[model samples]
Target: MNGLDEAVAASGSDVISASAGSLRERFEAAFMPNYGVPPLVPVRGEGCHVWDADGRRYLDLIAGIAVSSLGHGHPALVEAVSRQVATLAHTSNLFVNEPEVLLAERLLGLLKAPGRVFLANSGTEANECALKLAIKHGTATGRTYFVAAENGFHGRTLGALSLTGKPSIRDQFGPFPLDVRFVPYGDADALRQAVTEDCAAVFLEPTQGEAGVVPPPAGYFAAAREICDATGALLVLDEIQSAIGRTGHWFAHQHDGITPDVLTLAKGLGGGMPIGACVGFGESGTIFAKGDHGSTFGGNPVSSAAALAVLDTIERDGLLENVRTVGARLAAAVDAVDHPLLARVRGRGLWLAAVLTTDAAAAVQAEAQRAGFLVNAVQPDAVRIAPPLVITAEQADSFVAALPGILTEASA
Candidate 1:
């Protein structure tokens, strides 16, 4: 069977909108208009394909901002979530739950690092948890100032926002929570100078997923680790957008062999079920200290089960290997393009981004959508490409073949 057919069979039966225009109009009228009108009101999706209200199909490349690891309706996710919700949707943090314990165990084992886990509802929650851990670590030592890399994004919450380095996101939200120092990313000397004993943690992103999918220079993560070590500060790596096979590794830091003391993960962890986790290693791993930190919906049975399913699928389907192969092809395909707007392509595994010379990310995204393809302007001159790990080589080729024309049209 073809990829689309296989995907639908695995997920719930196909679901398409009755009328995209009607749905869009209705959504415009009802929604709070916070996100400024979604590109389209997607009613149904299977694997890497989403059908609009008008029965038009488009190849998905963003993968719900790297949240849909197994794609829209994989059998594993559907079955796991269905079974989990039926059995137990949520049990407050007051009691110990089996699925939550099991999922934490699974994560600890996969991490191959000694640590404790704090679960939450989203990447931002995970970041908030990590920040809490760092704060506690600092409180115990009588220090709390933090160091975050420039262009780095942690979460939107006040605590996590204290560690975020994005100017625009933080501009209106401040004055921020507490002491946070922003240093130039990939600059080891800057980091060394910035991090002090008073610093609770050093927060960074292995690959800046929201910063136009920017990958740090070689040895940057290692240097950050060393700086954190020297300063006795916990290193927090925000892998929300890069973790769980998005970069063909359990965590993107694995590529650099540099594991952070605290790693914040979400996005694809529950395969779009809205789950977040903060895994701390050794001392950093055990700093929660009872009532100092907790979450009501974190580590709920159903979400934990769904995360387990996503992990199982990643292993069973050998999606990481697929990522290595197909991702290389996608990079080459995008690089082969001949266009003035096209500058370069960068990223790892299924999480690729096409860099353009002009700041026409929005126009290119629109053109791609019009051409029956899906992409996003994750940054001013970059369109992030993070398709589902289950995406076939043929699908990658299809996007590549259509990209040049899309670029040409957009540049025109």
Candidate 2:
């Protein structure tokens, strides 16, 4: 049997037993249907690999939807979390903690811009905070409307969902906050027309992650910055999936040589622990007055320490350079394959997607899982590949080498 066949055969029994049900039963009984039913119940993970309940190993490329920056079980992350947990876990927003202050400082330093940060527990919360800040900042001038880009995803909270451009998800969740307009992404002219003096903010992603890693044209952000400046609107860039070294930079917008008035970050910020931040620059940073907004569990000691460790480890181990080098290597290798089924590669650094010629992304994802790899079919024709930063070039090449067979099986 070929490698793919052997892989499937070897895991067949485990798959059958898992489907017959123990974990799935327990999961279905307790969990909400929001995530649907997960196919694999992972027992443990280390480095770039995770093992299912049946003890079958799969190369984890999705990295918890781009949350696991240091991969699974890095010593630094574990040590930091454990130490902070033992010392103090939650202090709430009523009190300040060292880790929280330090993390905020470090983030601002990385941005190299004068800013203040509001911490939160998730990306949605961060975006919500940014939205609130934008509105509050605009209240002085009677600005009300918020402009976002089509196909851009900010988050799923009511406010953030209002800013999201995907109608399929947002349509069902509305009576969302009104006065949100969307222009086609990467169209500077559309944005210029959309952002009037009445606009409160214009939110965008450096690259649309949930829209299957669609990167905007070069200078798109720069032009948006100019438009927002001319219109006196805050430029809020949602870096939830594109920040924290995902694109070989502290923030993806930094690559465009532009600074946004507001920036939101979450995924990969705490390595795996949930944490998010809404950072506002210059006068925008000071818009949130007392009692403006707060989070009960935001910037908890444990999550803050974990985030600090993630930052320290990334700097100490030079993972940023690794991401740039290995990411380029992987992208080049995949493009060089020139498979008939493959359309093109999109995204930068470790965050990437392989566009397929056919609407077989879901099948390709399933085939990849069967072949002992984990990936995400973000769209009908796009397979998102965002492995942990710890993933080596060799590991990436392994996935690239398997693409042709995986696509062939998916087509069948």
lDDT of 1 by residue, 1-412 (tens): 7765566567764243246676677778988986777777565688899877666789999888999989888989999988988887888999888988999999999889899899899999999888888888898898869888888888788888877788888888899768899998888889999988888888899999888888889998898888888889999999999999988888899999977899999999988898999999998877876688878899888889999999999999899999889999899889889889999999998999999999999999999999998899999899999999999999999988898889889988
lDDT of 2 by residue, 253-335 (tens): 98899999999999899999999999999999999789989899999999999999999999999999999999999888887
Off by over 4 Å in 2: 1-20
> What is the lDDT for 153 in model 2?
89
lDDT of 1: 0.88
Model 1 weakest 10-residue run by lDDT: 12-21
- What's the residue-level lDDT of 36 in candidate 2? 82
Indicate which candidate wins on lDDT: 2
How well does each candidate superpose onto the true structure, as a TM-score? 0.95, 0.94
**What shift in Å separates residue 31 of candidate 1 from its native position after superposition?**
2.3
Model 2: colliding residue pairs: none
Q: Quantify all predictions' global Cα lDDT against the true fold.
A: 0.88, 0.91
C-alpha positional error of residue 194 in candidate 2 after TM-score superposition, expressed in Å: 0.7
